[model samples]
Structure formats: structure tokens, C-alpha cells
Target: MTSFAQSERAGLCDTFLEVGPDAPTLCSDWRARDLAAHLILRERRPDAAIGMFLAPLAGRTDRIQASLAQRPFEELVDTIRSGPPKWSPMALGSIDEAANFAEFFVHHEDVLRGVDPSARRQLDAAEQKAIFAALPRIGMLSLRSCRVGVVADAGSYGRRSLRSPKDDHGNVVLTGEPGEILLHIFGRTAVTDVELDGADHDVESFRKTDLGT
Candidate 1:
């Protein structure tokens, strides 16, 4: 799965290289190149040794992301495919690997949207779940309070929300094949065919929030 994801990430980067300089991306202020630079930077962070020791004080993901955004695209890609950072921990578990996978998958989609819309359909179930699980951990799921039904289908796993939480302000009936819903919620704005309710602005606002936007 990791190998597949890395290949996808590389493919996404190649797609971005073809984007015109004037093209816009989901990241409003960023051009396609800027987004590519950011992804590359993300993969090039200091080893886990330095990260674990100093991350508590200076390892803000946003800061790290911003710092990466400043580099040139080619340099960033070279860093990502290179061997793991020297200080990285040796005993990373499944969850950590999942997190890494999610990072590349989500950002790949984000960049693809701006460069090549067709790239969105390239994702598989394992990649989708890794993205789904990772988004919430990074605060992407906290976009808005809506009483929306959520149905997810990924390979053999399927789940549906039977009851809306009390805090929800409106109802959004999100029912579809699991992978579709996963794609919709995780930065795929083109999934307009999926069911949605409440004010369009609310949904749009949710999309604009810091979670993934």
C-alpha cells in the first residue's frame, strides 16, 4: 500500500509539473507549484529523533508545512523519494504508517484537483481509509455541525450513521457507495452528485475551513 501511495504521489507531482503557472488550486493563495513544494517539504522533515526531541516545542505541522511551501518543487520531490530521515524512529507502527500514507494521498488529491481533475478517480480503498482516518486526526472532520447521515463503503468495510448528533444544526443526508462519500468529504469537491442538505453556504463554509482547506 505504501509503495502504491508513493507511486501515486510521484504521479501527482508529475501532473503538477504540467500545470500552467496561472492555474488555481484548492489552496486559494497557492499556485500548483506552491502546493507541490509543500508536499515535498512535508516528506523532508528532520528525522524522528530530532522531531521527537524538539517537536513538542517546535514541531508544529502547520509551521513545518509552511516552511516546506517555501522550497522549489524539484528539490522537494527529490527529498521525498530519498531514504527516510536520519533521525526518524525505527519502530513506527501501523498507525504511523497510515498517517504517512494519508498525508500523501490527501495532498495528492488537493494538487490533482488543480492540475488534472481525472486524477481523483485513481485512489483505491486502502488509500481512501488511510485518508479518512488521518483527516479527523488533523482536525479536517470538525468542518461544521450538521445533522448529516454518513455512509462509508471501502472494500469490505461499510458504515452508516443512524442518528444525527444533537449539536448538528441542519441535516445532510450523505448516502452513497462508501468510497464516494469518502471522496466527497476528503477534499473532492467535484462529487456534486452525492446527496447534501442545508444551506449551500454552510457546506461551502465547511469546505473552506482549516480542516482540509
Candidate 2:
């Protein structure tokens, strides 16, 4: 089976090439060029990538990412298309599959869905399974502030708990294909098509929650 990670990478690369550098992304204040720089530095320069998560290091990270963004646009996009550097954790097959499946998927959507509001990708069963498998961990990052439990509806991929204290009644039951759920959890709630079922208060809270980047 083709790895979802590779598929997403290829798709994202193609979009980047198609759209050119100045196209906007769902990531606020970022364009395609900036996204490409982020992908490159995230894999090639661990020192600066830390800035993405570390407040004290953010300035350096921004400066480095800005520098990379200034490179020839095609070169930057090609670097992203070529995959991660050899020394990076993402270079390992297992790690790449496990770590980057959703990273690339979400970013690809960021580019695609941002450019075309009417766009929607129908993910296959295997792709949905991969996302379902990875949901628990990724959910922790994206739903850190969410108070409701997130349950995926039963389907070919089976049911999965994306968050704690799975309560079918009170907690939010997120009904959709895994890709939509992933996008919703990844802060694209306004764009992704998903069904949220829960008590009024819980659903409202879930709606207001900041599904972190």
C-alpha cells in the first residue's frame, strides 16, 4: 500500500508547484512560500524548528524560516517535495509514516481548501484507518483545550476515541470520515464537513474550543 505520508507529501508538493509561492494558506498570515519554508526547516533544521513550539526561540525560528522563504521559490518547493533530510527523524520510514501522515495531510488541505472553498477530498478507507489510528495522540495536541470527549462513529475503520472519558451521550460524537474529523480537530472546523452530536452545552463548548495548531 502506498503510505499516506508519501501520498500527502506528493499531493502537497504538487499543489505548491501549481499554485506558486504567493498563494495563501489556511494558516493565518502564511502563504505557500512560508509553508514550504516551514516544512523544510521542520525537517532539515531541528535547532530552529524548536522555535515553533518554544516561545523564547520563536524569533530565531521566524528569522530562519524567513530566510528560507527568500530562496528561489521553485527551489524551496522542490526541497519540500524531495522529503525530509537524512538526519531528521522523519527520514526513517516508520517515523515518517507515523509522524508525518497527518502533518502533510493537514497542510495539503490547508493549501487546497484555502484556495478553493468548495474543495473537498474524499479519503479512502486505508487513509481513514491511518488517521483513526493516529487520532489519539494528535488529538491531545489539537484538542488540549477541549472539554468534551470525541468519539468517531463506527465505520470501515471501526470506532476510535479521540479524547478522554468517552461518553456517547454527553460527550461530542464526531460523525464523519476520518479526514473531516482530522481537519475539524486540526482547527479547520469552519471549512471541514463534520457532524457534532452532544448536549447543547458540550456542543457549544466544543465549538468555541481552540483546537490548537
Candidate 3:
């Protein structure tokens, strides 16, 4: 079966084709071409990609990504469409599903919602299940700094209490579809559709916390 990761990759490429290289994306200061280049760089250049996690090497990663951005926009999108090169561990069957699903999904929305703020989509049962399955891990990463306890209320997918590294007495219940929840966790909170339920102070504190990117 074609995974949501693959589907999101294709959809992102299609959007890239539609919007062209100069199009805006939610990623700070990145155009469609730049975002495509980042994806390519991420999957194809491990040496440079290390900079993404390591602050000291970030300059090299930025320079390499900028160089890649100068390539033809169509070529960049095509490279992404073709999937990671064989040399990339992301090409492994399991890693592809585990890693790329949210990566592509969020970047895909970066394109779509960047063009139009109201352009969110609904996920099917399987798709929701896919995103829901990932919520716990992402929740932990995203909510670690939250002062109040965090609980994801993903409607039919049920709820998950996140691991907040520092917690006060209050709890914040984040209510939304899995995709919207994921988007919020990914630092797209301004555009995300999730609702927060908690004390005024707790909700405000949760809002003040930085989420994923």
C-alpha cells in the first residue's frame, strides 16, 4: 500500500508544480524552490544535514541548501518526487514511513497554507490513524518545555498525555483532529486549528511555549 508519507510527498510536489519556484511557504523566508531544496538536501546530503541538528555546522548546511536552491525549480521538485536517493537511509522501507509521514505532511501544508491560510484538509481514517500513531512521540518532543501538563484530545483517536519536562499543577487539553494537532506541535500554532482547554493561566502558558518546527 502507498503510505501517507509517499502520498504527501507526491502532493507536495504537485503543489510545487502548481505554485512554481517563487511561491511563498510557511517556512521562514523560504520560497517553494528553497523548501524543495531543503528537502533534497535533507535526504541526499547527510554530511550537511548534520548541521540541521548541530548548530556549529548549520552554516555549511545553509550554504549547500542555497546552492541547491539555484537549481531549476522543476528539477528540485522532480528530485523530491523521485524519493530519496538509494544512498540515503531514508530510502529504507521502514525509515521512509516512520520519518517522512509528518515531515512531508507538514511541508506539504507549508506550501498549501502558505498560499492560503484557510487551506487545511481532512484526513481519512487510515490517514488519521497514521498521524495519531505519531502524536505521542511528537507530543513529547513538542511539549517538553510546556509548564503545564499536556494532553492531546484527538477525538476518535483518543487522548494521550504528553511528557512535559517541567509541569505545574494545571493540565492543558489540546483538542483537534490528529493532523491539526500535529501541525500545532510542529510550530504552526498560529495557523493551526486546535483548541486548548484549561485554566486561563495554564492555557496562556501553553500558548506561550514554543512548539515543533
Candidate 4:
């Protein structure tokens, strides 16, 4: 896992450096540099760190990005590669290592969408596991409206399973590679690409509720 994390981190750093200053990202308002800064911040300050506990009031994303921008690009990448600071307020303890892998995998995809789409192909099983482990916590399924089943392509990173309230009432079989399923559930853009063996409404509603605005 450490080796995989290092590889993913290196890929991410390379992508960040490769993206032009004017490049846009899937994150909408954030530019490529902002995305790079975000990753650096996560490496340095995890949720369990002191800053998170103290300013508990301050928005973590904002704090991290602000800190990242304070340094030059070379310094920022150097800091991330050096690992989290010992005195950071948001360290995740023993799990900090896991968080490192998780952030790299997810953010790598985010920045890659703008810089290099092929970069995602480089993710290995370990990196996928780390990102998958973090998904449920991201609120992909809103129990208030639906039940989701996620299955990944034995080889993809964005797999997920989701059923709408209506689909739960009838017989249906919705299946796809994990990455496609997850992207659809997150209301990203995979729904059109996934195959539905039953009523399409279930997938439609799920997308509408989560991915669709």
C-alpha cells in the first residue's frame, strides 16, 4: 500500500505540474493549482489533526487550500512528498497513512480529468481500495430516498450499487463496473454509460437526486 500510495502521489504531483496555469478542472471553481494545493493540505492536515480539533469552526478545505497557496509549487510538492508535519493540527494518527492513500487516489482522478485522462488508468488495486473505503463516508447514498448496491468491475475504481424507492418496489437488476456505478450514483456522468437490466427509472431517480442538480 505504501508503494502504491507513493506511486499515486507521484502521478498526482506530475499531473499538477503538467497542467497549465489556465487549465480548468471538474471541481468547477477550482483551477488545477487549487486542486494541487488541496491535496497538499490533506496530506499535511487530516481530520484528526489539531487544527481540525481547535478551529473545529473553520472550514477544513479552505484552511488547507490557504496553507497550500502560501508556498511555491516546488515547495508545495516537496512538502506533500515529505509527508504530513508532526505538529499538524489535523493528523489522523495511525490512519494518517491510509488517508494519504485515499486523498491521492481521489484527488488524482479529480486533477487528471483536466490534465490527463489517461492518468486514471495507472491506479492499481491498493489505490482503488483506499478510495472505495472512503466513499460511503462521502454520503453517496441518502437513506432518506434510496437504497444502493455497489459492484465494481474487478478492475475499476468507481464502482457502486444504488436503487431508487420505486425500483425497490419492483424487480430489477442494475449492474455495471464499479467506477461507472459510483460515478452514476454520485450524479457525475456514468449513468448513460451503465447498463440497466430492468426499469431505467431507478437509475434515473438515483441520478436525479444525487448527481443531477
Model 4 quality (TM-score):
0.62
- Model 3: per-residue Cα lDDT at residue 118: 93
Residue pairs in steric clash, candidate 1?
A: 47-87, 47-88, 48-87, 48-88, 49-87, 152-178, 153-178
Question: What C-alpha lDDT do the candidate models reach, one value each?
Answer: 0.50, 0.86, 0.87, 0.52
For 172-213, candidate 3 gives per-residue lDDT tens digits of 888999899899888898898899998998888888888884
Write one digit per residue (lDDT tens) for candidate 2, span 1-213: 678898899989989989989998999989999999999988899989899999999999999999999999999878887887887778888899988989999999999988887798877777888888888889889988877887877356677777774344357888878888888899898888788888898888788889956
Spell out the clash pairs found in candidate 3. 186-212
Off by over 4 Å in 4: 45-67, 87-94, 116-187, 190-198, 211-213
- Clashing residue pairs for model 2: none
Candidate 3 has its poorest 10 consecutive residues by lDDT at: 161-170
What TM-score do all the candidates reach, one by one? 0.59, 0.93, 0.95, 0.62
* C-alpha RMSD values across all candidates: 5.9, 2.1, 1.4, 5.5
Measured on C-alpha atoms, candidate 4 has an lDDT of 0.52
Off by over 4 Å in 3: 164-167
Sorted by TM-score, highest first, which candidate order results?
A: 3, 2, 4, 1
| Residue 195 in candidate 3, Cα distance off native in Å | 0.5
